[model samples]
Target: MKPSIPPPPTQEDEALIKDYLLHRMLQTVLERDIQIFKTLELTMTNLYILNLQHIIKRMSDPYWTVKHQIRQRGIRIESKSWTPEGEIQVLYLCRGYQRSLLCSWPPMKEELKDRIISYLGTDLAAY
Candidate 1:
């Protein structure tokens, strides 16, 4: 006995298949776009929280003031922070610039500390 072949698809069947495939493709694209949008929203939120431009400006004054000291001691900016305690702390490294410095500038007034930390979207503990 010979094997039987299936009947060819009708035009209506072909149209239905095309429609189903197009629908699936559109759904896939929509899902991908939604994920991308979510990621963008998260990144924007973080950026808003950071407010990086203002943070940079806040650090600039102290950096300029200590630049001469830095040159003399070969100390470099290891880490820096405008702490929630209202202190401008910069970990300056010296001795071939590999050691953490224990020095910190005097704390700003308590009110200022509170304001800065609030704007930074974090508390002292978070910092």
Candidate 2:
């Protein structure tokens, strides 16, 4: 028996893949999971899109290209909203950086925490 081999990616496809890989790396850093390097050896994709140091350059001012703007990657962003109780802080992290809305506020904070746990199946974790 022979193992299946993936077809070679075209130039255009390669470009798209590169762009995605870059964005993914940026996203991971935004999530604040600086421990990605420890798990790189276990992943299938060798692109190493899990490093903060590599993508940190993209977030730090004076480097972001028009294509990988902060708003575009959905990583490293903060928002404040006022509820009847107090202020609510909505933070979007890039660690793994799953581009989902992670909560850390008065109301949304607890809800977001629960949401993250439900999706990732971990409890009491944050960056």
Candidate 3:
């Protein structure tokens, strides 16, 4: 009798494992960053927690209401489904004051760019 060998993992299994690892790494990094941000007193940047609706529904918290922020005023949050490449539930730490300033003067492109850079510490094309 010949000995049989186990077949290699399927593509779906590999994809699922990849996603799980990515999410775990993202969570760890986000947690660390949150601690650092808190310790450094980075009040200018605010952490926006997205995907709260799913959590609320799962927990059956009917009283919980999520106040949606206007993305035009700050860095837009990316959807995990669309942004599978290292995308997570936590949004960037945006500067509230900068967002407000930008909203105050939407027509001024240069002013908006400068404000974003000042707050985010980098010039992002997304802004």
Clashes of each: 0, 7, 0
lDDT of each: 0.44, 0.41, 0.34
Candidate 1 structure, TM-score to reference? 0.28
Stretch of 10 with least lDDT, candidate 3: 96-105
Query: What's the CA error at residue 109 for candidate 2, in Å?
Result: 1.1
Question: Which candidate's lDDT is highest?
Answer: 1
Regions more than 4 Å wrong, model 1: 1-6, 42-127
Give the alpha carbon lDDT tens digit for every residue of 1-127 in model 2: 9976544323433233233333443445445554554455665433434333444553444234533544353344434334554543233344223222322334434543443344344565564
**TM-score of model 3 vs. true structure:** 0.32
After superposing candidate 3 on the true structure, give the runs of residues whose Cα lies further than 4 Å from its correct spot: 1-8, 45-125
Better of 2 and 3 by TM-score: 3
**Which order, best to worst by lDDT?**
1, 2, 3
In model 1, the Cα lDDT at residue 96 comes to 45
Clashing residue pairs, backbone N/CA/C < 3 A, model 2: 28-94, 30-94, 31-93, 31-94, 31-95, 94-97, 105-109
**For candidate 3, lDDT tens digit of each residue in 1-127?**
9976434334433333333333333345445555565566444534422222232233232122111222222333223232344332332223222111111123233443453344345557667
Query: Each candidate's TM vs. the true structure?
Result: 0.28, 0.23, 0.32
